[model samples]
Target: MPADPEPTAAAAANAAESDGAFASPTPELWQALGWAPDDNQRAQFLALQQQLREWNGRLNLTRLVEEADFWIAQVVDSLWPLLPLLRERPEAPLRCIDVGTGGGFPGLAVAIALPNARLTLVDSVGRKTQAVQAMAEALGLAERVELRCERVELTGRQKRCRGQFDLALARAVAAAPVVAEYLVPLLASGGEALLYRGQWSDDDQAELDRALALLKARVSRREQRELPAGRGLRTALTLQPVAPCPAQYPRAVGVPAKLPLGA
Candidate 1:
């Protein structure tokens, strides 16, 4: 079980001066997730959060402008979704690729949490990839991560990325239908695609439905929870790719957003 939050004034001030007491969840944020790091791990995580904040200003890597919030929202929040998978497969090392990994939400956090896991952060933009690469290196996580500056769709279509990863992750990167096309080809058979989403509504469900049909995916799970302190609703949709994706997928970049397959 997780312990209570650290009640130091600095902790509170860090949380308060930002947008919320929990703007970004730190080690304190882990309590809400039902887990807590040991003192050593907590300190390491705090230092990493601070480093990310310092670099964020110069590189514009993220909009999580507050230091404390960086610990909570970006790091802890991203870590929450991975716990279930980790618990289920404790012995197996997870091999994951984050598609369109801008500022490394979920990807870097995952790397930090699961040191044993292998992560590949992929993006089409060179500058963004450079930022991720630099941050990972600064955090001393360079050896465990692979930084690839390439278009995910093109990469997926190629013979190489096919069935490469055990898991594929995307956070608010694209619509569910579109993301399915981009993810299916990259996932190994039976690999899972997890999407970090904001708010669950009929429209979102509709979009997911389209993607599931087109890609022959099955909804493995949907973890719904309110963001910390009533910020808003957030959902993590996990889909299992049961079959190979069609060749016409990903629809050239703007195509998916403009005219979604099931739209």
Candidate 2:
């Protein structure tokens, strides 16, 4: 079994004391989630926030640099989708990949929650991946986190990328179908892809349907919640790959987004 995640008391304390878009979740939010970081994990989260701010000035990794915004938009948003997996308490270590990991949002944050879960972060931007690579190294997470500065389409089509993950994650990146094209190729058969979005509409579902038909994946679950600090709405669509993706999928690099399935 993977080792238990220890808490970071000092950082957790600071998290509890602050209030802002970047402030840690309020007491109520904590209660609702029924999960809280231990002393060590809280320290990791603290370190992540600091790195995000420091790198933002140089790499412009994200606009959500303020503490409160960072927590709500990047940290918490990344962790929430893993709630189901955490609840299961699986004994086996997991494999997870984050596509289009701009500055390593859900990928790095999720790594903190599931320390044993191998994390591969894929992004096309060299500087962004460099920033995340440096930040992960600084946090001493280099052992667990893998960085790739490549387009998802190219990575997804590679032999090394196929059927490698228990979970594939993409956030604030693309519409549902487009996300499926980018995510499904990396997931193991029966594994899941979690697509993060701000809103879910009937049209979006319809669009997703067309894409799923092509991907041989299906919507397994959909979750919606108000973000902490009332920043905005958040939607997570969980899709399970029922079959192997067609080889041509993920298409040539830059193709999926431009021609987006179901478009």
Please give the TM-score that candidate 1 achieves against the real structure.
Answer: 0.84
Highest lDDT against the true fold, candidate = 2
User: Where is model 1 more than 4 Å wrong at Cα?
Assistant: 1-27, 38-44
Q: Candidate 1 residues 41-93, lDDT tens each? A: 56656666776677777777777747445755676567667777545653367
**Cand. 2 TM to true fold:** 0.88
Model 1: residue 147 alpha-carbon error in angstroms:
1.2
CA lDDT, every model vs. true structure: 0.73, 0.80
- Model 2 misplaced stretches (Cα beyond 4 Å): 1-22, 25-29, 90-92
Instruction: Per model, state how many residue pairs clash.
Output: 7, 13
Sliding window of 10 residues with minimal summed lDDT for model 1: 1-10
